[model samples]
Target: MKFSACLAALFGAVFVFLPAAAAPVDAGHARVELISERDAALPGETVYAALKMDLDDGWHVYWLNAGDAGLPPQVIAQPSSDIKAGAIGDIVWPLPHLLPVVEGEIMDYGYNHQVVFPFPITIPEDAMGPVTLDVVADYLICEDTCVPEQARVKLKLETDQAEANIREGELIGKWIAKSHVPFPGEARVLKKDLNWSLSLRLDGGFGKVRSIRFFPFGHDILHPAAQPVELGRHGATVSLSAADMTDVSKPLDGVVVIEQEDGARTGYEISAVEGPPLPDTSGLGPVGGVGIQVAAWKLILLAILGGLILNLMPCVLPVLSMKAFGMVSAVSSGHAGEVRRHGIWYTAGVLVSFGVLAAIIVALRAATGPITLGFQLQNAPVVAILALVMFAVGLWLMGMFELGTSLQNLGSGLADRDGDAGAFFTGVLAAVVGSPCVGPFLGAALGAVMGHSAPVVFTFFLAMGFGLALPFLVLSFVPNLYKLLPRPGKWMDTLKQFFAFPMFLTAAWLAKVLGDLAGSGAVAWTAAGAVAIAFAAWLWQREARLPRILAAVTLALTLFGVTERAMAPAPAIGASSAYAAKYEAEPWSASQVQSLIAEGRPIFIDFTASWCATCQVNKATTLKSKAVHDFFAANDVAFLVADFTRKDPAIAAELARHQRAGVPMYLWYPAGSDEPQVLPEILNQGLVTSLPVNP
Candidate 1:
């Protein structure tokens, strides 16, 4: 019996003393191992452990939220006998790089080459001997194809005699340090109609933040695309498009990554409170809020003042002659009440026109991204309609048709009733023609309104409309102002005839706007339409049935044909000689600007349009001056002209970036400074020459 027992004990001793095999047995595309920071640990102490993975070339593992596609790696740790681990802390992940998946279809955030995920292990006081732990790791490695991989890694940590492995501990320490720190501020999510606005209230703003990007922690919260981040002095707000699958009740967690112009990056983890009440978006609060209500009020005041100044611009001046004629005729006819009524009707016309314009802008902005003032004129069809209207108005003033008279007296006399209707239509005409002019102080106010909420934008427009009507409104109400006008006589006829020339000139200018939009083909059609309308007017003046019938038919056919051609897609600038000479500029692109900035070149960006009277004036008077041209050439400035004559979202965004509602926006970027110095709306030779030249 003793010999048999000795034989059993000898076999057991042999098996117990044999060396155990160390695991992390390699998988196909990745090598994952369970590693302990310390060789040993004392009882009742915490130890750090990591599941380290090294992937083969061209293979990557997903982040916690795999964005559009893929799955994240998983780790499950099991303790051996007599080894107790409290709970494994959450895995600490390093910052992930963005990976384009599916080539232009989807994007995924992930890591390649290597990743170390550190987890905590707890040892109970009663623990004895070596501590053994097993980690089961499952991960998907992806390149052209994805491969599901699993590895069982075992780690033995001696607890009886604690010993530290400095190298391994430092590696774990490095990974732990790479984890994202929590954002130091109050962050809340505010719902704005169909989208979400994330507001981060930092104490002192994001200093020198060139760009900010956000990554959500899960699906069904944010769109898997980038959003525009509007920065303020105190913080930043990012416009986030919500996914249809988002659960509004749940909180949002994400990372706010900021990159400097010099390419340095910093990241912070943020937890945003969901379901907050919508905040006030009126006035200037939407323009970077910053808790300053006064600033918004100031912007509104500026908008009103800007509108008052707009009437002085050359674009609106010609229309005022019609208003003056209506007032003089009413006073001479001994209808004093009609003057005030005309003013009221005209004011109403201006206000209603502005309201409709604002509503259209708001709707378009919601559907598309940023668009600018005079955006409607960018459409060739719209320009064509406006041109026809201008031509008809000119012809009417030239005695082609009589107002309020019988059709039989078509070309003989003016309207017999009060000119209130004419005054109202004139106001509407003024607003339409005045849209392309961005006068002094108007650019800043409108730019701020454009970047703000819908309510604020509309309010600013109303205020400006009021300012525009103020001058005429006062003139009608005050008898002293009207008495100064010359009495109605033969001179009135001469003056009226002379005014027709200006109307014709204005129509000719709109023809240029149409030409820029649709090329020479559209211009030719416009010229034909003009000829047809003039001939039809002459035929109508004959007071014969056959001529009038033929006139109506000719007018209808001309408009229908012109409308069809005007609505077609504009010919490419390179393919159109008229457009080539009209602009004479290189196409402006966002990427090209960035590339030039990267090369540290001084840049001069001129945001202009063919229809904008202010833009044309600045170009002819200041930009084309010999002194300004010479200075630009000597300074090695890259003269880039962004023609807003056509609708371009990129140019609109650039204008918004510089706080300009419309053109004649002149920007000067000195070498070594990314921030541009905006020149005045009305430029002079001194303004161009005074700019500092880079050595």
Candidate 2:
């Protein structure tokens, strides 16, 4: 279906070449030109030509299919006897911005800047002389007032001297790329009171559309001024007002202009079936007593808040504390400049990491279907690697080995080369460690990104990183805060060593996650890798050049060997598994969920993963509590666990269906309700126990 939609958009969009140009002629408030795509065309060749217009500020011209009350620009090609003009194809229209003419009366779709319309001309083999073409163009330019415009441009083409204008060719190419075609999914039109409502179901990928607008190509059908587009995650609906009730069953065709979250504009040509509107299956749309749609700006703010709260999460606290102490040490050392520089570097690191992470997620989602949040954690090799990394950090903090002389002086505020590097990596570490524990504000913000454009998603992630770094940034600039920290002493060393325990605990937790993914053998491999890492670090620190080289080789071999070993196959789903033993809920499947729904039983779906610290915490507390279990039992709610410890396309789709990128998602479906209520990231017994149950 997606491939067919792409082909429909690409049909008749072939590129042709031609040559010729005329000086821009001033017509009303716009400048018009007849430009050719090539220098000259040989006999029996098709020539591509374009009508270019540069409109004055605030003034616009109509599209080929002018809606409601505007005239479309017209082009008449009269070639001399030697050259015959073929039937011009559809004018390649650039996506038009919405133009409101009268208050609540008329909307015009057109262009205000540079606009290009492409056409093709054919020359016969029997042509005798140089081809001479005479073109007459007519258009209406309008701002507050409208003006009739006309231009006649003549072009002489010489076969011997083929015109090649690189700049003009590039400009035309850019305009062509910017032009949009029809969406590659499904769209339908339903008859409403004096109007038709367009409902569209777009394919899974097109990363987060910021907004969309529709331009009706037919006259006396859709009311330009009154149509409004309502956007959802996977679909959009627009009300098209009609001129009269005459045969509304014909397929509705028009161009859809979409502005993505990143400010990119594209268009699609759609031919929608005229029928009764289909039922809304996409959960993104509104449902009574269910999820509420959050505004974009609000989502951004929530992302920031989520990032701010992440500093306090158990997964991130240890690394954050170390960074904070380092910042304080710099402040107490009277190196104000160093403190600010370190803060800036740290912020850059965080923002860059977030940008990269968002890019990877968006790109993957576009290429493959939906993917879970922290997708790396779902891989056995990744979990094993992360465990080793955490263990190494723990060793470093415990003084098993020093990074460098400069980095060891953490109290001096990484002012030197090694120290600066440390600060930047620390920022990166914060992002990595903090990911497993979804904060209260982060869940919705991250979820929103899954449903929106790439740029919008990037901005959300950036906002989060900024929020996470904001506290340290303030402390670096504010000298008063430095007084709160005790002076650099043995206690500083003791505190650093004490923090290593948390790192070790985190490493152990990741090892458990690895075990759950690739079986118990992967845990053994991870432990063995940790031992090799310690031995290598010890040898490198104590020995000379040759020994250090050997140590480096040994370390590399150990890492690769362990990752490979940990990636070995695990037991099947039904086999005895650690995850199965740990959780009491029934395994979730699409069929089971649908069956429960059909049976009129309320459902509680826990979308979770073994690696997610937040998921484990919630499972141990709110979910397992007797009160919540009793409430579910009494209400006849089927408890299903959608475990995302490994990659599952169906589970990924389910998460995407709910606009979630990652898990620890708690969904409550009241009996007889089609929509499920999305719960907060953090949960308590009361929150779960109090859910409304329909009898």
User: Whose TM-score is greatest here?
Assistant: 1
lDDT for every model? 0.73, 0.71
Q: Write the per-residue lDDT of candidate 1 for residues 224-320, one digit (tens) a residue.
A: 4435555543566665756775787777788877777676667789988864422221122123323233356777788789889889888888788
**Weakest lDDT window of 10 consecutive positions for candidate 2:** 281-290
Q: Provide the RMSD of all predictions against the true structure, rounded to 1 decimal.
A: 11.2, 19.9
By TM-score, how accurate is candidate 1? 0.66
Q: How close is candidate 2 to the true structure, as a TM-score?
A: 0.58
* Model 1 ranges off by over 4 Å: 1-211, 214-294, 407-418, 451-453, 542-550, 574-586
The sequence of per-residue lDDT tens digits that candidate 2 reaches over residues 74-125 is: 8776654244435344467767777767533466777777798776666556
Clashes of 1: 0
- List candidate 2 segments past 4 Å from native: 1-295, 406-415, 574-581
| Clashes per candidate (backbone, < 3 Å) | 0, 13
Task: Return the TM-score for each candidate structure.
Answer: 0.66, 0.58
